[model samples]
Target: MNKYSVDKLPRDIRIEIAHKHRKLRKQRGLSQTELAERSGVSLGSLKRFETKGQVSLESLLKLVFVLGRLSDFESILKPDENLKHIEKLFDSKRKS
Candidate 1:
């Protein structure tokens, strides 16, 4: 359960990510239009994401790639030693 009286975790995270994107954009000295062009994401998408903190994954990926943060996903959903430890949990859930 969430601790806050007004909890909106997904929105909070989205806003944080949006702020990071904006900070990175400024640090790299690129305007919104320039980032959109270099990332191949539509300018409209960029504007909406910055203003509303919402974006499609495809659009986010394009921006992240252009910003050189794609490696941040290196450990996501990877099945290796950690997966082996919890393999039985996965099987049990699947069987039920």
Candidate 2:
């Protein structure tokens, strides 16, 4: 199997992301309570996310904003380079 195949499971990805977020929070010396207060997310939501990787997008964004890692999400769902090239080709064909 290819390396990318291992990441096909959303559950795995969510767990990995949660682990990374927890590590970053610890590295920054912020406890869960402190982070929740600063990010305006409920402590219950934060705990759920840390333990189960379940969080709403808005809450996750708020948490990341407080952690200064919101920019990491900027590239998600971006158009692929190959898709852009194909779109350009189609545009040129349509203009002909």
- lDDT of each model, Cα atoms only? 0.87, 0.93
| Model 1 C-alpha lDDT per residue in residues 14-71, reported as the tens digit of each score | 8888999899888989899999999999999999999889899889988988888888
lDDT of 2 at 93: 96
Residue 17, candidate 2: Cα error in Å is: 0.5
- Name the regions of candidate 1 deviating beyond 4 angstroms: 1-8, 78-86, 89-96
lDDT tens digits, residues 2-95, model 2? 4667545788788888999999999999999999999999999999999999999999999999999999999999977668878889999999
Candidate 2 clashing pairs? Answer: none
Error of 2 at 7 (Å): 4.5
lDDT of 2 at 24: 96
In candidate 2 the C-alpha lDDT for residue 55 amounts to 98
